[model samples]
Target: MTAADFQIDDREGGSVLRLTGDWTTTGLGSGARDLQARLGEGRVTALDVSELGRFDTAGALTLVQATTEALPKDAWASRPEAGRIYAMVETLERQSAPPPRRPDALTRTFAKIGRGVFDIGHEMLLSMAFLGRLTTATGGALRRPGSIRWPAWFSQGERAGLDAMPIVAVTNFFIGAVIAFLGANLLTQFGAGVFTVQLVAVATLRELAVLITAILLAGRSASSFAAEIGSMRMNQEVDAMQVMGVNPFQALVIPRLAAMIIMLPLLTFIGMLAGFLGGMLVTWSQLSYGPSFFIQRISEDPMMGTHLMVGMVKAPVFAVVIAAIGCRQGMSVAGDVESLGRRVTAAVVQAIFAIILLDAVFALIFLELNL
Candidate 1:
């Protein structure tokens, strides 16, 4: 077969592209580039394929792409196969072409912001809906105590709370120690280093213990719930349960929710004690305050019990938010690995965010009430 070539003639009407030689794979080497370059020099108003030889799909594609104008009908009269190939390749190229250019940068940024706001609103609505469903399910279980899954509740409690005790205890211990160190360092300058006892006691009992424990559960238990339920979703097990006249919310969600509600407060109590011990040890080692003196100082603090009660009050709320976010994200997962992963991540993030926001709201309400 001859090498592909094209000749451009300056005709009276306009330029004419006359394709020649073999346009098959091996024959079309430089011809594609030469044809494109010639076409770029000036627009060809007419196409001539009369003398084209040894044509194939490759040759047709080259000819179709070399000029902007459509192939003349008469040019393909002598070569109907070439015409068919050209038509096919031309249609495919048109279908595969890139989309129109994107909006300008400012417009894109505004669009992104708009989408983000919409997503946040949508997510809030979904969460509220989930909470309503959870409340309804809980009411149903309360009406018929036999529907409550005690075994599942115990199992989830063991996993979410009992297994998490060590990390929560250790983390809060260090947090309390750090608070003691900072308080002593600052108060010593004002001849008030002894007040460090009150600082650690109030901080740990009122905020640190509960907040830290909730954050830990948000990361650990929330992720676990999302992944477990998301896997169930991906496998269509949740669907099967519905078909079998089962309520997934009762079997799967309520137990976890009950577990979190019961276990988080217990964990927070443990964290508060651990934190007090840690602070006591730090004060004994860093300052000259003995364990007896530390204990005495904390015991004498009038607001200590109030602080403890306040912290305890926040746990159930935090528990509900964390468990609800996790279960909701799990239920939202599509039948895919990517959706499962995304939902798991979103569970942790949304739980943490809700925990912090709720904590801030609690702080405001307590402040207003002079608590």
Candidate 2:
């Protein structure tokens, strides 16, 4: 192939650029750059591509870029092929150019909000779809109990429930103590310090214990589930399971869901006992009310059992939300460490938010029912 070359000759009106030899990518070499530099020295009024041997898009782009002004319609009339290629390049350049003006602040802000709303709606749809699939898998497992992975269920239960007891108990205990202390201080002003026992019992049994336990699990087990399953997804292990005809929901998600279902209620019960103990101790220290007095006061309250029942009933529901959100986020992970990290963080945040939202719903329902 002949090497590409260009010549600039002064003409009557202005300069004329004459492109010659093979203008294909392999023949252009430094000739393209040299042509652009030469064209920058003077305005070229006309293009002469009649001698552009073996021309291609590369040469067309170079010629188009070298000329600041648009080429005349007949500039490449002799080389119709070059005219077509040049037109194609020019069209692409026009299409790829940036927008003329940036959006204003108000427009940008609204766009961002719109995107956030859209993302939230999309996420809700995805989560609902995942839940549907999970339900189907669970039904299948129930039909064939032999396919259930008991060891995994037990292992997850121990990790998420038994191992999490200390932190759950400690947090609830302190919360209860604080509530009792506040009640004693405030109630004493009304000459009703003895009512502190009833306050502690009702609060601990109806809301604080279960709420705190669920929040703890949201931070703890939810992140763990997301990370574990997310790592599997990243490593393509989930895909392998699918290839082997294994239901990822049954093998991975169901066990974790089952564990959470079985363990959270048990943990919440433990948390309630710990909170009661803390409240009793605080009441004793602050009001000179012994543990027996605290117990007697709580036991005598007709609504205490109802409060406990309300709290316990929320446990399983909260557990399901936490497990489902975590596993769903994990399944959505891309095959990258960054995606795994992001999904894990999202799992914890989403779980906690859902827990709070559901708790509010439960509270409203119980209030309406006069429970």
Could you tell me how far off, in angstroms, the CA of residue 333 lies in candidate 2 after the best superposition?
0.3
Question: Stretches of candidate 2 above 4 Å error?
Answer: 1-100
Q: Which candidate leads the pack in lDDT?
A: 2
Per-residue accuracy of model 2 over 116-197 as CA lDDT, tens digit each: 9999999999998998999999999999999999999999999999999999999999999999999999999999999999
Looking at model 1, which ten-residue stretch has the lowest summed lDDT?
66-75
* TM-scores of all candidate predictions against the true structure: 0.88, 0.75
The global C-alpha lDDT for each of the candidates, from Candidate 1 onward, is 0.91, 0.92
lDDT of 1 by residue, 1-371 (tens): 78888888987767887888888988888756677777774667777787888888887787667767666666678788888888888788767869889899999999999999999999889888988888898999999998788999999999999999999999999999999999989999999999999999999998999999999999999999999999999999999999999999999999999999999999999999999988999899989899999999988878888999999999999999899989999999999999999999999998999999999999999999899
After superposition, which runs of candidate 1 have C-alpha atoms over 4 Å from their true positions?
1-31, 41-59, 74-79, 91-101
